[model samples]
Target: MSSPRASHRGPATMFILVGFPGMEDSHFRLAFPLCFLFMVAVLGNCTVIYIIKVERSLHEPMYLFLCMLAAIDIMIALSTMPKMMAIFWFKSTNIAFDACLVQMFCIHSLSGMESTILLAMAFDRYIAICYPLSHSSILTTPRIAKIGLLAIIRGAALMGPLPIFIKRLPFCRSNILSHSYCLHQDVMKLACASIKVNVIYGLVVIIFAIGLDSLLISLSYFFILKAALGLTQEARVKALGTCISHICAVFLFYVPFIGLSMVHRFGKTHGSNIHTVMANVHLLVPPVLNPLVYGVKTKQIRHRMLRAFCRMKSC
Candidate 1:
């Protein structure tokens, strides 16, 4: 009989998931779509970054946040999509134990960074729309840069312990991860040892860090909306237009995230597949849609991208 550590039957059984049981054929189905999505994500985010870097007119707090967001999106895609596509296409899902922990850490760290950056953006928007005269003084270039650095540091510090904790867990069983990538919860389940501490810490981080950030973002928007309502029709329309893309992005990030958490907590067994799909969407949707949403909504970015594309073609 094969030891539990040696069996590759379930993701919970192997150090790395070689493949899924019934989903072998489904891998082929996902290959082209995943590849196409990955390319689009990378190209779209790079375009945003390029536009910010090249366009001198975009050197304000808003565009700075946009640049930070683009960078984060690139990191997000880099962390997860490459491995996922490799798994789908080449069936190379055998990530080493240490590597799996690293991947999970990177994924969650970038995700936390993205959320923090979004909150910063919300505050920037709030100041701009709610107190336009003071916005420039309050959100200078140096201050914005500092905020970006702070975002990075906060994310790294918050998620830095996850991999350490995971590494300390005894892998009495072989570590196979369900789904494509090494998510924290899935990876933790592979440990035959007690995971109450891990789970508790994870929830605490989620509640205090992500939850607090999200709540503050919502409050910022609430005040922003109230201020917008007081403006003239044209100003209100302009303000609404300016924020619509961000509002969409925020909703895209949080709604599914909260739903996934609730499902995990309350409807675990019955909603397993639903939870999985939502979790995957939570990871994929923001990176894929962020650039597109901002590009279409922000005229400056769109114009800069078009000019950049034309220049590239002419060369």
Candidate 2:
């Protein structure tokens, strides 16, 4: 699956992954923190997912959306963490070209999935807070299922062609990537062939997908806020309370996503350090913090976790 440093004489079948630019001497030391974060992300998300699955009381629309979010976080971590850590710990930087493409697709597609699910979560919150009586009926199991299915399809359809586009181009330039993991933009940047199509399509996907989704999410919150403003002080606080966790999650995911996308699109002159750090945050922070945010911010999850731990301790 690995090969020697590829030459630029012909098409590249192997590429070098630069774990962290300007940190060659301290990669081993740096790997520790990253590995710890990876483990926490995996375990935290898994715990949240399992808790939701086994607790019948937590099977409401809000909890269901949280579960889906946790699962997506797990997938996002799995997609990039292993190979990234391998590069850091074992110094295995050579990645097969095809495998790199798969990683790229998974990262972007899953990001799209997270963005769509966040939009859906915002809608769920909107219904629950603004139209409490219809919340249950509106976000029924079948409807949630359809949203999930649509998210999957949209992510795939938008990002699936990226790898094919990259494959069609010939990579005769440098094969060194600036980040620890494979990325669509990073991969295509190495291609000696023209990438006008890739650029346009990439922008279209970003604009229509996450960009539109964020705008809609904002609109949903605008309506939710409008409805909440009509309520009494205590009632308004209670209504907005239910949305706090989701709001935190949306910021965590979108802020980094938008920042990284902008860096890729327009930060060409920026230092590689900024790009690398931004990329790591975009890939790592949401998975690490999303479940934690939900776990701490949502009372039901917090109580359930407390009770579960108390039982484990025979308290």
Best-matching candidate per TM-score: 2
Which 10 consecutive positions of candidate 2 have the poorest summed lDDT? 1-10
**Model 1 C-alpha lDDT per residue in residues 1-315, reported as the tens digit of each score:** 232354433323235553344567888778788778878888999988888888889888888898899888888888888887788788777777777778788888888888898899899899999989999999998899999999899988989999888877766565555567777777787776788988998998899888999999989989998999899999999987888888888888888788877776686573146656766787888888999999998999988878878999999
- Mark the regions of model 1 whose C-alpha exceeds 4 Å error after superposition: 1-14, 18-21, 270-272, 309-315
Model 1, residue 224: C-alpha shift (Å):
0.9
Error of 1 at 199 (Å): 1.4
Instruction: Please write out the lDDT profile of model 2 over residues 79-114, one tens digit for every residue.
Output: 999888898899989888889989999999999998
Q: How many clashes show up in model 2? A: 0
User: Model 2, which residues run further than 4 Å from truth?
Assistant: 1-10
What are the lDDT figures for the candidates, one per model? 0.81, 0.88
Clashing pairs in 2: none
TM-score of each: 0.91, 0.96
